[model samples]
Target: MDYNLMREFADSWGLVAMALFFVGAIAFALRPGSRKMADEAAQIPLEDGRS
Candidate 1:
């Protein structure tokens, strides 16, 4: 089934692509306004005091 070839390909570009995706996700999660938006959304129900 050519396991060696598959492993080599995965180790080459697959690893790089995974690392890039992780970095992009982290950057997006840490971006500005993300936390502020979350905080505002959380306060909406609280201001109304209604579950």
Candidate 2:
């Protein structure tokens, strides 16, 4: 419950960890063959329950 301690952690290792996670997420989203999955997801609402 100490604001100062939390702030210090976030200013160092926490920041690095979050940055790495963001980069990894970006890499995964941009990987090859992702477009087809993204397009299918984008069409879900228009399927009209035709499944």
- The number of the candidate with the highest TM-score is 2
Tens-digit per-residue lDDT, 1-51, candidate 1: 499999999999999999999999999978998999878888987696655
Q: Candidate 1: where are CA atoms >4 Å away?
A: 40-51
CA lDDT of each candidate? Answer: 0.91, 0.94
Q: Clashes in model 1: which pairs?
A: none
TM-score of each: 0.66, 0.82
- Best lDDT among the predictions, by candidate number: 2
Candidate 2 regions exceeding 4 Å error are none
Candidate 2 clashes: the total is: 0
Q: Estimate candidate 2's alpha-carbon lDDT, on a 0 to 1 scale.
A: 0.94
Superposition error at 5 for model 1 (Å): 0.9
